[model samples]
Target: METGDLVRELRTARGWSQGRLAAEVNAACGTALTREYVSGWERGKVRPGPFYLRALAGVFDVPQAALDAGRAPGRAGGAAAATTAALAPSVTSDLLGLGFAARLRGGPSADDWEARLDAYGTDYMSSPAADLQRRVAEDLVVVQQQLDAPAMWSAAARLMTVYATTFPRQESARSIQWFRTAAEAADRSGDVGVRVWVRGRGALALGYGGTATGLADLLADQALALTDRPSVGLLHATLGKAYAAALRGDRPAALHLADRARRIFDAAYDPSARLSDYSIPAWRMNGFLSLLSARLGDEKQSAKAREAALCELPERLPRFVTHLELHKGLTLVRAGDREGGLACARAALDALPQERWCGTLQMLMAEIAA
Candidate 1:
């Protein structure tokens, strides 16, 4: 097989687009290779350099020799030959280890589904979107099949939350659809906690996507009503409502909800609780508060929230770090530091994966530009 054929086959097998494959290659090798470059290589118009070849090997989990042999006209037949010699061992091992045949016949275990959900959250911002979407689709199948199992509802809820957060702008309808499915599954399984959590996430998605702020408020209010007492979920849902109010230019309502959310978070938040994708940490809520205060033109409160966010920065994920920076940048802009804010916003955007450039970030960038 030719190298181009091999690259194309491996990428297609994993359900990756050319751009996504290029992104994965760049992430693996710490080099910037563009979609056009990948397209050229796959079209046989250009050959991959050593760096790209090695990166492709890592991305596809194959040997360098296999890629090299694929490029050699007389070395082997094409991807078929390379697959037989280079891919068989790993493929067979994965099939056996994952119980591929059995899973197809009997569905995945709840534990397996939970593990995949956790993995999705752990790598939410870093992984290639095409790969992540494929995994989510596969996991959703298993989750749907196991909806009667209470534990699976938790997994399903997490999956929906991650899906909504990761693809808020690009897949708005699909995200909402899955969120509804997650809520229904949780309710059917009698998991009110998961149901409320999913509703809160759905509200955030709606607000962030600028789809319907009223619906966002309704969902958040519904979630708040479902919680009996103070809880992290209630805090998140209140914050979601606050965020919706902020986006809608309702300053008084936004500030009131922000204060309410903070009070609940202070009372109910347990540091030792296992953090899921849906769980909003104190630092993240602070960041959101900063954005809300900035939007409400309360420079003093915005600065205070910014300080709190910065103090808690070290505990955040890279994704949240960038998010916090964006919030801080917006606060700075609201304080009349346009140049400084633009620079900080640009830096945060550059630090994240391209697939993670959602509507909220885009709106912040527009504000900075203005």
Candidate 2:
């Protein structure tokens, strides 16, 4: 096929109308590329230049030269993009919910992450959005081969604690490998921030299935004291601590840290959104706080926390954040009201953040029934 023919063929194959293609390309670029422009390119009336090439590469996920050569596109769903999908565990669907939420809050550019790497290296432990922590973790898995990239590795270390809470019993050896690689990469760079990040990862791993001794408190301390000063990541660590304490039935300690985390939001940084705008502020602790209060039978506090979390939460959460709603729903169900709890669970099920969690939540429902 000629250029126009190729474009038409690929676009049709993906079932993308000009508008869909334009929207995808627009998302890839930092700016919107209109439908008319998309129309022009597909018709081959005007060849796409380098800018178009980069944007198209992101959209089609193919090498620019290949796309130009009229080769098949490399998208996860499209013909050419199948390689990475096949090689990886197909985590894109899970990560995309995270990415889309992040994209809503912040534009994705390699340069932005590169700059974050540099800034974080100096003081890596502090001040991170939830999305950054998550992306850095997933990126380590995708680019573990690029061990030379210190910035990437540094970011990855910090992200470990975030995902650990989300993935509890589901943690895998691959997850540990990613964490170890990131930690080692940070150590090689001699980035203290990375060290703090690494410690957080270790603490998180321990909490997941290993040691629990002082895990919560020690993690918060390491995250805070590792660098020149306390970092927002310390709060993230605290969040993990709170979760761990809850698992331990240490209601007082968990609630204390969860409350502390909520308080920290008052002084939180205003980073641009990534994956989801909600990840930037790193989610409303009030949600957890409310749920915790419910678990503890603090009716007044539970209502308060719920109101705050619901208010602070953006109307439309990125898919990644939505996954936690299931856990929250479960907490509600186990509290006292089966019908209301099931309703909450149904809402989360309907939202369908990530597919992997589908089975987990389904099982959780069965357990709740039993």
Candidate 3:
């Protein structure tokens, strides 16, 4: 096989277009290459330089030697191969065969769709909302046509969760519309777990604005009612209710709810689980507690939660870590260190990428400055 043939095979095996391949290469190598370049290279009209060859090797998870040899890389044997083999199916379909027809099919396979959703969920806290929203919207167009399939219901629901969160909080109507769609999808899926997940996430989205406490409360109640199990869903619902209580100026109730959320988190959290939006990490729970405590003017509790959140914080989630710092600033403001608190808040905002800042962060900053 020629290098071009090998490149085309690998790209098509992953169901990527020339444009997608170009995007992946650019992302990996920080290059400005385009689909036209990808087309030229695959047609043997142009050859990649050493730099691009190395970039392509990394993107394709193959050795530079394999590309140079103009052959497919040898697969490993046994269980690991069994697991990954389906992800890289043989690209033997020629234009006429049923295999070729299926290869040209529009919708993603169940596993592919699920993996995409999982990636979206895992990247939610780290990626810019606009970027994440664009990616989710692209997938939504394809998934929307297949919602009648029970297998696609969970995908639809999860995609709606992304839409619900990515919309600005001030756009409550748009956000709630997605939340409602997610609820409908979850119900149609008939998966109790997904139903709980949607309601819990919806409650949090509604609670963030401080004006939709009633809707947040209702969603949280439904989330809890759907499951007696100790789960991430339960933790989120409890946190949502805690936020609603805090917004309503019921400090004791908020504190109690936060404590309950912590217990559910302790019982349910799986250290081995994939780190996605569907799973509540200790850091996220602590951050919420810190924010809620700060809002209630409980400086000590807020400080403890802030420190706990910081200690377990992951490097990828800068926005969340920044929010935790803002919570500390809020505590400082409540303690009369007005100038220091404002400085702290400003520093936190400065450390985060401006594109990732959202309405919730702005609200926190406003509270600290006020």
Candidate 4:
């Protein structure tokens, strides 16, 4: 196949329009290439430059060689075949089986949806935010139609988590709205555990928004009330309350709640568990505790928590690494290492996609600069 045919095949396989593909390429390559440029390449009207070819390879997760190899006489499509082979299994699965027609036919199974959500949650730190956003948009539509289905509540809750984590600063209102919708879906499903989990997540999002500390406390308390025994969900909700207390200058209450959260986390944490009620791991709890400690003026305790979080860092979850780094940055600032703290903040920002540029992080950067 021609290079143009190869480009069209790959783009179509991913279900991305020319414009969307161009946006992704720009984000990945830090370029200003346009949809018209992409269209020209696809139409064989213009050949892509070396930089553009590299950008396409990065966007497609393929090697430059795969993009350069033209079709061989007997082999049908050399570059396209090589590109497909180089793609990740998940991407290949989408290319082969997932499309608009498949979506119109009612979408993938709940297990498949859960698997994709797991992948998104695990890879949030390093994956392109554009890809995550596109997946969420596609899944949200199918999930909305399946509100009455058994898996809908969990699916909605996962989307809420993604939006809250990935777009916290830029889309705060939308994130809260998604969390509320997830909570309502959980309620409609009559799943108390799901409700508690969703509410706990919402409480964190509320705390992150700065002005909703009181509502954060209320939502967390409500979630705790729904639980009889100690759980990861309750632990997360308790941490949310601690954050709220710290935000409001109630250091005593914040420290007390933080201690309680640590105890609950100790009792409820399971390293081998596939999923937690709140979708937060114990190490992440340590990161949050470090932030709370920093806010409460306990630099020693903050350092201790940061060390623990670093020790428990998971391999695949770069987001947790970013979170831990952010906490460390704040802790360093509290310890008077302003320049070092700013460097750490910049590293955290560097790990994220440009489109997911966080408001909170920008605020931290400004504070350090000031």
- Return whichever of 3 and 4 wins on lDDT: 3
lDDT of 3 by residue, 98-175 (tens): 333433575687799888988887888678887887677656666776666777898888788887788653344445
lDDT of 3 at 187: 84
What lDDT, from 0 to 1, does candidate 4 have? Answer: 0.66
Best by lDDT: 3
Clashes of each: 4, 15, 0, 0
* lDDT per residue (tens digit) for residues 287-332 in model 1: 7777777777787887787788778765545666666677777777
- Superposition error at 179 for model 4 (Å): 1.7
TM-score of 3: 0.68
lDDT of 4 at 46: 90
In candidate 3, position 291 carries an lDDT of 83
Candidate number of the best TM-score? 3
lDDT (Cα) of model 2: 0.52
Ranking by TM-score: 3, 1, 4, 2
For model 1, the stretches where C-alpha displacement exceeds 4 angstroms are: 1-104, 119-121, 125-131, 148-154, 208-211, 274-278, 332-340, 353-360, 366-370
Estimate candidate 3's alpha-carbon lDDT, on a 0 to 1 scale.
0.75
Cα error, candidate 2, residue 262 (Å): 3.6
**Per-residue error at 196 for model 4, in Å?**
0.8
Q: Higher-TM-score candidate among 3 and 4?
A: 3
lDDT (tens digit, per residue) of candidate 2 on 286-313: 5546545544556677666666556655
